[model samples]
Target: MSVIREGKVKRVLEDPESSQHVIIEFTNFVTAGDGAKKEELEGKGRLACDITEFLLQYLSDKGIETHYVETLEGPKIRCFRAAILPVEVVCRNVAAGSFCRRYGIDRGIELSEPLVEFFLKDDKLGDPLITEEAVMRLQLVNRSDIGFMKSIALSVNHYLSELFAQQNLRLVDFKLEFGRTADGRLVVADEISGDTMRIWNKEGESLDKDLFREDSGDLLSAYVGLLDILRKTDPKIIPIRSEEVHVMVMPKEGIKNPPGEVTRKGLIRLGFQDVKEVRVGKEFKIVLTRPLTSSLLKGLELMNIKLLTNPIAETHEVRLS
Candidate 1:
């Protein structure tokens, strides 16, 4: 593995097996106070990794593509290669924290529209939140990109708000990042950990940032307790695919128009053995003799299926006879 870059909590490395990307090793140190102060909080890194993985999986299921791939080791997360944007996208639906301190807004007051803010990723300057004009003046990103990012960030916050509400928690605010892949597609990047979010309990008690601010001296313990509650309340399991495999041939365009036998033959020529005729918009099932491989995944990508949705499987199981 070749070292690409090292940050406070993660290190990027070039994987020799694939030229297309690198992996990120998540670290154990937690930093606050604009990176001026650092503390080795026990289990902080693992907690972050777990929370991030959960959020990434949830978002991906809702048609959002994130940089997360999988966990490599105990607390390390592997991610695809990308050029990271140097701005933190903050989306808030309610007034809290800096929003209240800076603008004299009442905490917990809902806004008519979601507020999207951008902050430069400079720790020395205390990561001051700035306006889009300031971002353009500094040449951080183009105007069009900023507009697109704001739209996407608002969409993300809406999605997350609904999701957490399902879990009986209020998502006060959160930060997001974006990265451009090698193919020039911009996707949501970075970890969505507890540190980057403000989670509130049913009683409107702070479950996240209050640990750091209240001087309670048991921040890590409080975080772990919250994790335990989450695990017990909303455990997730990946469903096992049935022994019978289902394969469907979806046309690139209209489903109402039926393809001729020659088109079916072409599908057979394209390595789709046992192609069967079926009614439009109906599913067909086929049993597979082997599990899917990386090559097959690449073929699916070439067919544009990967770009249409997240390609990473939530869980993979193999069968051999």
Candidate 2:
């Protein structure tokens, strides 16, 4: 398809078959500090796309209108094309990030109620915070649209915060963009992923892009972890099965694994100095269509040894349940 717009981490392309939709192709580029820091991280695009698709669909199911249509191949998604508004709506629940910096307040302070803020979408001006009167004076969007966006933003925050809480994560803050379709219907646009929000685990540890921004941990690992958790929690994502195969692969004794070493050093850097060893491995859960038998169990274990793991460097265990 023909390219319509290209941003730091996404490309918008005209859909050949659908006049009402556009294809959003995600890229591997990750940025922080308002594009001051950037890196091309492999697999980041797919993770962001997957997370956004899940979240937008979740919101849509809860009666929120969004631009998401459906996921396409790889990191691309089909979405309704809309004239995106020049304003960004931010919803804050717990104090963190720029809020603390701007107001000189400590992080982790819970607000009695959700706070909605607006900012200009212009990158040149650092997206300066704009007042409600300024939004109307600038004519970015009419008063009615502003009011609707604010109301929708608060509603979205309520649902999203609860969803994250169910996953044992705190939605510290997030940004949302709205757009008007060709038919003049307003809907949520852009994306909702770790890139556009701050998520903290129960221990106040970040499971979002802040890991990459602060050089604290692995960004891809965090995204993958989040995806795994969500998948497990979403009952509709996986079908119920009578039995399944569980496989765990690990480095053989005395074998040198570079990832394990890297993880060890990373844990040490993160103040886990007491950690003596770290072994990075792989785990797989395969749903089965039939009952597990002795013959099939043996075959799976053999397959794991022959194909899934290196006999000389790694060992694997297969279990059926």
| lDDT values for all models | 0.67, 0.83
User: Tens digits of per-residue lDDT for model 1 on 166-205?
Assistant: 5688888989988877876566788887778787867777
Clashes of each: 0, 0
**Candidate 2: stretches off by over 4 Å:** 234-321
Per-model TM-score, in order, reads: 0.67, 0.72
Badly placed stretches (over 4 Å) of model 1 are 228-321
- Model 2 Cα lDDT, one tens digit per residue, 251-271: 997888889899999999999
